[model samples]
Target chain A: MFVTLWRMITFGFQNFFRNIWLSLITVLIVVLNLFLMSLVSGLNVVGQQTLTAVRQKVDLSVYFIPTTSEQRVDQIRQELLRKPEVQSIRLITRAEHLQELKKSAVDKGLVDAAIDALGDNPLGAGLVITSKTLDGYGAIANTLKDPKYQSIIEDTGNNFQTNQTVISRLSLIVNRVQVATLWLTLLFAVIAILMVFNTIRVAIYSQREEIGIMKLVGASDAFVRGPFVITSLLYGLVASILVTAVLVPILSLTNPFFAQFFAGYDINVLGYVREHLWTILGLEVAVGCGLSVISSLFAIGRYLRV
Target chain B: MVTFEHVTKTYQRRNVGLEDVSVNIEAGEFVSIVGQSGSGKTTFAKLIIAEEKADKGHITIGGWNITHIKHHEIPTLRRQIGVVFQDFKLLPKKTLFENVAFALEVAGERATRIKSVVPQVLKIVGLEQKMDRYPDQVSGGEQQRVVIARALVHRPKLLVADEPTGNLDSINAQEIIALLKKINEFGTTVVLVTHNREIVNMLHKRVITLDHGHVIADQQAGKYLL
Candidate 1:
């Protein structure tokens, strides 16, 4: 039985070389399928990273009027920080806020206008409140609206209004992308299944007579299917190599552009690939070969009726 | 050693491939089934291999009743009964040697057995020199000989040739018939199904003539009587 299995594997190898074009064509199809899937998968990785970084930069600020005393503002900051949902709150004084705006200003004209307006710094001390997740930032914003903290607000709490809108919009976009990626992966998976089915169907058609002859010569169904399964395995192996070769360099080159948004974040898709090297290759081979084997066996069993 | 008792094969409940066919052949005997295209000669061969099961009957081969043979056991029965079709059925991509070796490969014959058996069979069929040549490289007669070599790999007790020479010329047909006779002399039961009346008459073996799914004649030392 070992000898038979060895011969079957070797025969499959030889037959693959014998029909090089067909094997190559099938492998090419597999590569295209995997390439598209990997591209979508890689894009999803970048999308999540970008979304997280953007959300991290966003926070609601509760500012007091410039006339409000520093002792009261400090007390309000302490009270906000004590809330369970508030992960962190930073007290930004009027001078610090003015300096931050001036440092980040892209235009010198805006800085001059800000200093000249009202003959003094109109910017007020505020507390920049951040939550653990962007989704819960709105709740923290609503908590600041309580009648107890009404004195903490300056200018009817308009400071957090714009930030709240941005966070909600970002959250909606992220949710939509998640749904789209889910459906897209599902769609591609279906296409991959169909391609595997048709590929195996055509392969069986080519081997139809040979299958009958093998059966006539006393070859069991397992014996007949072993070669095709091995053939598909070779196809999967080649496809995985091709996809890896193409994806590694492309990801390495593009990850830096996306990393600029999030400090200390590296778009090292190659690193991810390296970390999961065997697993990724194994998954590709398993999916590609497993699909072909299942579809071919099913088709042969139904149509060949052997 | 094969017998078909009241075997009937109906396809789609309309076409009769084989109808209540009853026949028997003892061990080491040579039999020719002569018939027109649709006379069920091929179907009879298929029935023996259990490719087409009889609608109703007890069909036995070499003492095993195979009328209701399971799918898994069919291959074992097929291995015992070597069959050669008119199409040559040789893998086009493989050489004459590999084509012959495929049978041994499928049956898991040892390298020692394959190396020893393949060359010997090729020599018997006069294809020893052309073993390295592909099917396209060989003549029709040589291709048929390679297929014959393949059929003989198992050293089967029963050999069924369904128009083994249909694609070959008269000279090739004569060579094939001679080879069949030679194989029969080695104690293999040969069942030759053909329409070649000349080869049939020349064999002077037991002949079973069929017309429209009915066996009209079964003669020892039979001739082409149609």
Candidate 2:
């Protein structure tokens, strides 16, 4: 058994090196397939991060009547905190609102005119509420419309509606991209499988006479089929190594571009790839070896009838 | 020993490969099967090695009925009976040494055993000096010699040669026949399938003549009478 296994391994290497061009082509196809798979995964991570950043920027401000008590405002803040959708909330006093308006005024003359014209702080106190998700904003808006707080609330800011539109549009784009990437990846997977199958078929076809001779000389099915199967596995192993070697440097070089594009969103593509290197390589090995083995099995089956 | 009890083999279009043929050869005998093209000589060799199934009867080699040999058992059967073909089916990418060692290698022989046996067989075929040469580098007769060496590596109890000299000239053909005769003298049963009357007449051994998939004559000390 050891002798048989050794012969299989040596013969497999012999076959692989003997057909160098074919092996290269097979490995190239596997690399392309793996690279596309990693690209899709990377895109998904970035998309999720961008969506989270957009969701964080969306908030609803509830303005209260100036006569509303601080205790009532504190109650509303506590109630919002109890809800899972509300990520955070902060109180804005009437004085703070006026100070913000005054700071935003381009000229001191306009600010003074506004303060003198009003004769007092006309701004109302409010609570600024940030939600965990895009849908959470709508949930908070519904909660604010309750009759118990109707008299105390003056108006809800328009930021929620504008941000909702942005969130919905981003969701549509992301969903479409996900679907398209999935289909493209699947299509490339099919092509890669067929290419492996055909390459193996041609390799076996060239060795058909040798296969017959082996059987005639008392070679078992395993003996005749082992070399081809081993050769295919080598192709997968080498291709995985090549893909990793190529991907790491390429990702590193492109890191700055991706980092700059997602500057404030904090989507670190390079970091994600670095953290998941093993997982990515593992996936590539599984796919590369799996496809080659299946293809070799099918190709070798036809000539083993002898 | 080999036995064929009313063996019949037919093909997809109802073409007869062998038709109700029955023959037997005892141990340590040199037997020749001669026929024209499509006369079932090759099919007879195939059946002995369990390459084709007997359609209507039984075949036994050394008392083992291989009429319906299992797929996996074919290898074991083949190892016990070395087979040689006319085309000299040598792997082109392998050297003569690798070609001869391949038979034993497939049988799971250790490298030490292969090293010892391959050189001995190549020496018998007078190609030990040229063992490192690839098949394409050798002459036709040398290639056939390599095939014979490969077949001999197993030291099989029976050797089946199906027109092994068909592609060679008269001189090379005689050399191959002489080699087969030498192997038979060593007590291995030899079954030579051919249409070459000169070699068969020269053998002066038992000959089975076939015509249209049926045996026409079976004679000890037979010449190619057909």
> What's the CA error at residue A250 for candidate 2, in Å?
2.3
Off by over 4 Å in 2: A61-74, A87-133, A157-173
**Which candidate's lDDT is highest?**
2
Q: lDDT per residue, candidate 2, A1-306, as tens digits? A: 887898999998988887788788777876776676666656666766776666666677788887887678988999989999898999998888778778898896888897899797777788989987666777787788788877688864465466567666765775676677667767766776777677667767878988888888889999989998898899888988888888889989999998888787767877877898899888878887887888889888878888
Residue A101 lDDT, candidate 1, scale 0-100: 80
The local lDDT score (0 to 100) that residue A8 gets in candidate 1 is: 79
Model 2 TM-score? 0.90
CAPRI-style quality class for the chain A–B interface of candidate 2: high
For model 2, the local distance difference test gives 0.86
Best by DockQ: 2
- Model 1: how far is A93 from its true place, Å? 6.0
